[model samples]
Target: MNEVYFPYFDPDFDKLPERINGPTCRVCIDNESMDDCTVVKVDSVNKQGLLLEVVQVLTDLNLIISKSYISSDAVWFMDVFHVKDEHGNKLTDQKVINYIKQAIGTTRETHNSAKAKTYANMVFSPEPNNNNEHTVIEMSGTDRPGLFSELSAALADLHCNVVEAHAWSHNDRLACIAYISDQSTHTPIEDPNRLASIEDHLTTVLRATITPTPTTNQPNQQEAKTADFLGGEGAVTNVERRLHQLMHSVRDFEGPPSRTASLPTTPSDSESDEEAGMKTTVKIESCDEKGYSIVNINCKDRPRLMFDTVCTLTDMQYVIFHASINSDGGYAFQEYFIRHLDGCAMSTECEKERVIKCLEAAIERRVCEGVRLELCADNRVGLLSDITRVLRENGLTVVRADVETQGEKAINAFYVRDMSGNKVDMEFIESMKKEMGPIALQVKNDTIRPSSPERSRFSLSHMLKASGSLITLLLSSNPCKYS
Candidate 1:
């Protein structure tokens, strides 16, 4: 009889002891295979703290988490750790299955991330002229920890050169297109069987597709770098470098780049534009579920432009806070709130309107800038039922919904709307609230107060005329005078 030796994780192992002290540990149970790494979905009421704790736990386990993606739905963390099998072979495994179950019980948490959010409605096609010079893989599913890196590692093991890749996560579902070519040998990965095997391996670990030949080489290198970073060394720094270049491209607001829609050929009169620049706030209210709602403000020099920019937040229902007019005669500042009653879906009209509005305000165009959107809400039965009624009566569609709460306060955020611009009445808002009670209050200036009934009319009407959903929260004006 032959005896086999195996290496297991030391329960008391302490490398980064500070990371896994006490309740702050991300421990995975019952996973030993390299290909079948498990993902534990931890949805503690304390999501943020729980996420931090999980990170610490992985660190304590001496595992290297490649990416920790946070979005409106849930926190997705991807990691890799060196593990020794019975044969003493170092291997990489995705610890997603049982690990998630061990931490959060058997209940499967929703898979939503900025990367793989667009799981549905995405069309993948094979890149033409593939006479064996390239291999394309369009993989998208729930964004899990190490999905990309593990795939890249598998590719590396097979000695493939990644030529192009693009990926984005909306609600933790990831969609990615990767183009690969055989190592310097440049061997054509043209075998259908080979392609199927690759896809099978990817599906096993990533739970994503491995399609052959898709879309011409409109390769977004930034996405490739992101995938690389999530997969291994020097990727994060490289991504940071590119981000720095993008930042330098814009002259102001070293913050993330703002979305700018193409300017209309028939521009408004110069004098009128200047007047639009003078207005400090553009309050927009639209009918959602209850009365109406407000979105965000674009503080660029043009108030009208900010108004148009409201189309971008079409996904969420919110109320307008204020869009500060900039002194530069361009779009300067913008703010808005996601409302409880506004419809749950957005229209193309809203998207275009917001884009045009932002352009009017003076936001410059750039490549690969951060997309700004917000969803803040805790789960509350009373608030949701109220908002739901308004949405149904108006025939507004809900594209996305998430309820997240921090501290003791609850925030309910929804993206919805009437795409065809159906008329939503005030009676509907009133009736909905009467049945479900008052809409939840938004916290402002560190003080929280319920929205008044009259205010709902103003808030809702303003939201109806709006284009984008208001995701950016307006920081309360400082009442503290400077010394």
Candidate 2:
């Protein structure tokens, strides 16, 4: 069997192996699959962000959370997410579990089969309710970006009052504790048809499976806890009874549309008849201090278009920091983190705006004419070879080079300056731009050419090295290279 599929094997084939098992849900025992995984102690403080991050990952993977809980601060919040094949059988495949563990940030720790299973089962136990006051919905799964925002928006539109909400992330998985009450209970949720419609909508919005807890005959601590979890139901009677019964059913909320109709066409997708553009990444080193901000204006992805982003620090205004940029087709993407010196207050408001304007102008200058073309391609070993050969063969001296890769494509920019410190001929640049356009190429000449020897000597070797390394990383990946 392929290594990634080894974990799905059923051991012993006797009693139904415990539906769940593992120490912390993040620690997966499977070396192959991440089909159904768990994360542990997610309810603790300082771990909430981790849960959101995990949810973001799961949303990306198309997996859904099945069970979750929020323990008191002293207790760890345990969460479980399941992976099912097309046939609907639980898949314990090691490969799927490992992918999930990595996706949810849990693979770093030791795996405990029994503990993971126990925690999953604990949350998955049927939640039964006989009364009707509030509903407790527990969500858990791999984390992904925009998952929370979408869920919150749907709930707001549904008129469901979210009285209590606690979210946590541990091991890259996300779990949320939500106590929802129908404020317009005048038309209570007693009607089955109404309940089913709302339930189905919730499933679509969350992109995860949903289950209901069964209401018990006798009142129990869990019921009171559920009521308290819903923040006392406010002047409503029988809150406990209502919460108990509502908890029985589980509802999955799917994510946003895979491809929204409203999404703007990216530069890479534009036709050749569209405008041309140049994309570049800039690195700045400055002290982290008060009153610094980065901003961009009219920057969009396109051939010959301006791709701009900024980095400024407010706490340590005078602290030193560095930044860099990268591009895809005609679009530019940037990643920069700032740090502050000891005991520095954030930058003041005025200083923040100044930094933003500076970075924005710095980038806009190159693309002022507009982007003529843009494309995305993988970064291959021969990328630099092709660039330099083209420049040298065309008699264009490459005074400096800045290169970056997004997905498979290598973005290269040649700051060509003649030996006399004058800029390369505009006609030559235009010709080169035209030739490179078919292969996702761009060219920019700073209107004011650099004449000083210092300008010519400063090679972007370090920046290129950093960007190049990322392209060389060859792990098991889907390699979605978006321009």
Candidate 2 global Cα RMSD: 28.8
lDDT of 1 at 287: 45
Output the worst ten-in-a-row residue range by lDDT, candidate 1.
474-483
Per-residue lDDT of candidate 2, residues 1-483 (tens digit): 655644565665543422333333433332134444433223222232233333333333333333223221222434333333323445445555555555444422312111110010011212223224546555444333334334445555666544433332222223444555564652233455654655556556555432233563422211111223331213122221121223221111112122342122244233233343432334333344432222323333422121112111221133222222333344545433333334333346654444444444333323211222221234544334433443444444332222333345554433333333233454444443343332222333234333333321222233234455322211111111111
TM-score of each: 0.23, 0.22
RMSD for all candidates, in order, please: 23.5, 28.8
The lDDT, on a scale of 0 to 1, for candidate 1 is 0.33
* Candidate 1 segments exceeding 4 Å error: 1-133, 169-171, 208-483
Q: What C-alpha lDDT, on a 0 to 100 scale, does residue 48 get in candidate 2?
A: 24
lDDT, model 2: 0.34
